[model samples]
Target: MKFTTALITALFSVGALAAPSITKRQDTVTYKIHDFTERKYNGVNISTLFFNIESPPNSGGNIKFECAPFVFPTGKTSSTFEAGHVYFCYKDSPYSFSFVPGDAQKGTWAKLNLWQTDSKTKTYVGDVEFREPPCRAAGPGKDTVCEAQEDYQIHMSVAGSPTEK
Candidate 1:
């Protein structure tokens, strides 16, 4: 009876000592606005390639999508960039902002292998391509700041956004 009581006491002591050491892994990231896709038809891109995303420790993360674009005819060049804001606690599974099913980015979404956090690079390169929808009356025109560009092909790695943990 005495031995049994001693064992129980020791176990409780160990549990109390070890409980405080375990911690949940947290990943924090921040990305800023860079430039638009490197294509001629990118006139339709929402000025900012993507919004600033910051997945904070406990805020369930947050995303600020800047779905804005230039109002006038803007020539295509890597140099053209808009002054945008940076947001944190944010986060896409699809090529879609709609999340309907097939990404409306172009009606199709191919899961990129670079979906991993370790896949970070200065510029993520892939032979990305998408279908093209000719400019129709209901849509943008040939030089009208409204063009259907398949922008998934090349990704610029310009520190694309400075992110950290």
Candidate 2:
């Protein structure tokens, strides 16, 4: 009985030591509007938000924020950005963003993956083409309006939790 008990304890100890340790970290990132442009199209407003990653000047770093163009249908005058519509450019790098889903005014949770394909898959294929939309806003809100882009100062926050092993 004593030998059997010792063997079982040793096996359990070895198994515990072989197991990998996992740690989870939650982080929130805030990005500022470095540049932006808005234009009216078919009675609807189209806006493109640009953010420049902070890097040493003259470093030749190619870090950039790549995002799909966001269209604000008629009656969308909140000036707040929609969730799951922005992506960071880095060789199809995978990233996740957590934010308030629907109406920013409503309390809802939404998560977005940069390389999300279909409903439940993310594929990191290759380089992504970067296309910066044109800036043009005829009247009304001037901040997003390219005519007064110098005064633009909007900050957006994205929260994400990643597991580390």
Candidate 3:
């Protein structure tokens, strides 16, 4: 009985030491848009904009955008308006702005678009667009090389206003 108990305890100790604990951190990113250009449209100044987006660590092989209007020229007479379609690019990926409005389907890809807030709910308005990465032809009889390529870009952008939750 003593021998069996000692062996069991030793086995348990070895099992505990061999076990590995893996912790997964959540990847949530923040995006901002700025550098609004004032253009004369019908004698009125319209805002043309650019964006800066920060990707969270461990982006989970994807980028997400939530669109909403922002309060500009803050305090007393802060103007709010709906911004138009935004654009993004990833340096590591070979994807283009080929995303369409819809959920992800097989071979379907997407990116985020920022919009204005809804007056009633005080929530930002926006939609997600799916897109596919650009394709490249492999060298003669070299399918393995083309198939192994991966995306590595690390930046994204929009046309007007910042988008967040």
Off by over 4 Å in 3: 1-25, 45-47, 54-83, 86-165
Instruction: Give stretches of model 1 more than 4 Å off.
Output: 1-48, 56-107, 110-165
Better of 1 and 3 by lDDT: 3
Per-residue alpha-carbon lDDT of model 1 for 1-165, expressed as tens digits?
899999999999765543322123323223222122212234443222232222233545332223222222342212333323221111212111210112456577322211112333322212223343233233344322223343332232223444310
lDDT, residue 118, candidate 3 = 24
Query: Lowest summed-lDDT stretch of 10 residues in model 1?
Result: 92-101
What are the per-residue Cα lDDT tens digits for candidate 2 across 80-104? 4444445333223233222222223
TM-score of each: 0.20, 0.27, 0.20
Global lDDT of each model?
A: 0.29, 0.32, 0.31
Q: Candidate 2: misplaced stretches above 4 Å?
A: 1-26, 47-63, 70-165
Error of 3 at 13 (Å): 51
- TM-score (C-alpha, index-matched) for candidate 3: 0.20
| Candidate 2 whole-model C-alpha lDDT, 0 to 1 | 0.32
